[model samples]
Target: MRRLSTLFAFTLIVLGSCSPSVKILGSWTSPSMSTTGYEDIFVTALTENILARQTVEQDLDNLLNEKGVNAQSSFNILPPGFKTSGVDKNEVLQKIKALGSDAILTVAVLDQTNETRYVPGTTMYSPMGYGYYGRFWGYYSYYNPVMYDPGYYTTDKNYYLEANLYDAETEELVWSSQSETTNPASIETFSKTFSETIVSQLIKDGLIIKE
Candidate 1:
């Protein structure tokens, strides 16, 4: 009996170490971005759009890593451009049935924006003769140097992503998390920093991670 007790205690410790504090598994759908009023600007800044998606995916991976979760065992990210609208619960279930995962995470991007500066200016030049005369007279030209003007431009937008965790077999949403943010520049440097910021917030707010 004493030997059995020791073995059981050891098994418990091993299980505790191996198990993810939060058991989320199955296929995860990438968040969808909303196409809204800033269509024109969004098209113009295509790079930012791509970066935003990449950042979100990376952030999710990072979160799983931090939690000591085996990424492959816990989740599989769905391919890009996979539409969730008409996909029924059964369909999701069928696809993940083989995995026998614990849950499914669905992410959606509600809104996003990218902004850049548009500075306008022109160079000033004097006629050759005028400059020659000024130089000859040891006097500067009366013409004023052109000044460049930079205007503050922003593409203010809101983004929403809904994460739905479903049972692997039943495919029912058991847990969900939605996130929103404004003016996320989408530049690599800023996007990564902001992505981490937002993910941390989500984990905090959802009580997914201990503070």
Candidate 2:
């Protein structure tokens, strides 16, 4: 069975709301490498949206730190004008080295899709009985009219993201995972779940030991 990438059952889920949460689509870990965790990991999220980049990286940093692992968000260390579309590999790596980060964690959006769904209206039974005859009339009078609640169409958005962990010293990918999040209500909520899920998966894959 494919494992669901979740360490904690986040309490923010709203019933029938399709609240934002991350679920792994697939993942792979390097086969040749033995299990040992990195001492310090530098976290980066690729996005043009500054808020999103900051939110996820900070959340990841907090979770990793709680596990006794050192984690730093690139937002705090990188230049303000850095763009995700293109980056200087050597300069970036040199910065990571300066931070004493032994591992590099990067997150990027893979895809986004929107779905529009129709919710059928609901009927309510109401009575406004009065007047008239015996059993037949009484039964007929028991209910007056059918009331309907108007239905609406709603659009749902799904986000696909991929996370990769690299051995900073070797610059070799140690693990990679792809995840899907549906109907994220807000960036805050998405970042909360996304960071939690990624941290949990790293521990599971033995990339970040929970010491």
Candidate 3:
């Protein structure tokens, strides 16, 4: 009984040490932002990598729409050269207004950094078999030696990202957030998970309603 409890406690410690895929570092909301929440929203992601940008915008747009938030991806409306060639800002805003979007959400990757961390090794005990663990004397005789795991150093990549929400009508900033994602597996995975994280937070902040 005591051994089982110790094992269970160790399991909890390992689980608690795990890190989330996406973590919000900080957030802010404008005092003048609407209290009723936004309905039609435009989503965009800023990145030199066109594929990454498109994936993020599309994933986030789909997530919001699934929640009945009426979201649109900027990639669908913006020209192919809009990002690469740097189109006129005035013209882009004019086009967005025609889409009937009441709010705009833009995500930008500010920086990517490599972080080195040392994971300390832990000791584990393995029983011979279930039958062997039946009696205390049997278990004591069959008790495995303390297996010491060697510690190792690993490098993780962290992407610093920022999100900004703007009221379309007034063209003023509303909600802003900064977050970090550690060691994203792939562009698709990052987009999907990060989109979920952002939507969940926006709902919590009362900036958007799931509806």
Candidate 4:
């Protein structure tokens, strides 16, 4: 009886972990979009496109990994122009069908911009107490310790991504999501972090995993 109980508990834990946050059961693919005007303030146009594509691909792969789905075996990344025609649902469906995909995930770069600021500060003093001779005593303080200030630091640029999922067989809209944020001044420092955060959010939202 003891051994049976232990086995049952272990099985439950495995099952729980196997459960996915998203429901991307059928085969899936992403659409290709023009890379023009997608440049960031610091990253070159070519580099921005490459980073965006890699981020989106990584997000998709993370979704698959969470759901235990294999893209190479169960999914495929179709060639460009599959859904770039801006056609109606039926036409899009036809296009996806031609690519041998049961479902399609389209990601569009709606907007991409960036802003940068260099913050400068000095030590602040706060009157703490009075000395024996009635002189004031103060302590040194930092102007801003939290690292985020609205007035001193601001962002003028933002990045936006619009994602849409469609059913190829039925030509029906399945899922849609968007991600937008202030562009980091340094792409080298922020690209990977931003990508991982977006992917993690997608998974947490249960929008890109299989059950």
Which candidate's TM-score is highest? 2
* Model 3 stretches astray by more than 4 angstroms: 1-20, 83-88, 122-148
Local distance difference test scores for all models: 0.38, 0.76, 0.76, 0.39
Runs off by more than 4 Å, candidate 2: 1-18, 83-88, 124-140
> For candidate 4, what is the lDDT?
0.39
**16-98: candidate 3 lDDT, tens digit per residue:** 32243898998998999899999989997754456666777888989999988988888767644555356677777877888
TM-score of each: 0.41, 0.78, 0.75, 0.43
| CA error at residue 5 for candidate 2, angstroms | 25
Model 3: lDDT equals 0.76
User: Candidate 4, residues 1-211: lDDT per residue as tens digits?
Assistant: 1122322322222223111122122222324321121110111111224444444455554545555543211123333323335657565345446545544555444444445675655544433334424432222222223243334664344445445555555545555565554434343334344445544554554444534
lDDT of 2 by residue, 1-211 (tens): 2332221111112211555878988889997444677879999876656666777889999999999999998875675567547777787788888999998999877666668999999988875546535577576666545667899998876666789988888899888999988877666777888889888988888887898
How far residue 48's Cα lies from its native spot in candidate 1, in Å, is: 14
RMSD, one per candidate, in order: 19.3, 7.0, 11.6, 18.1
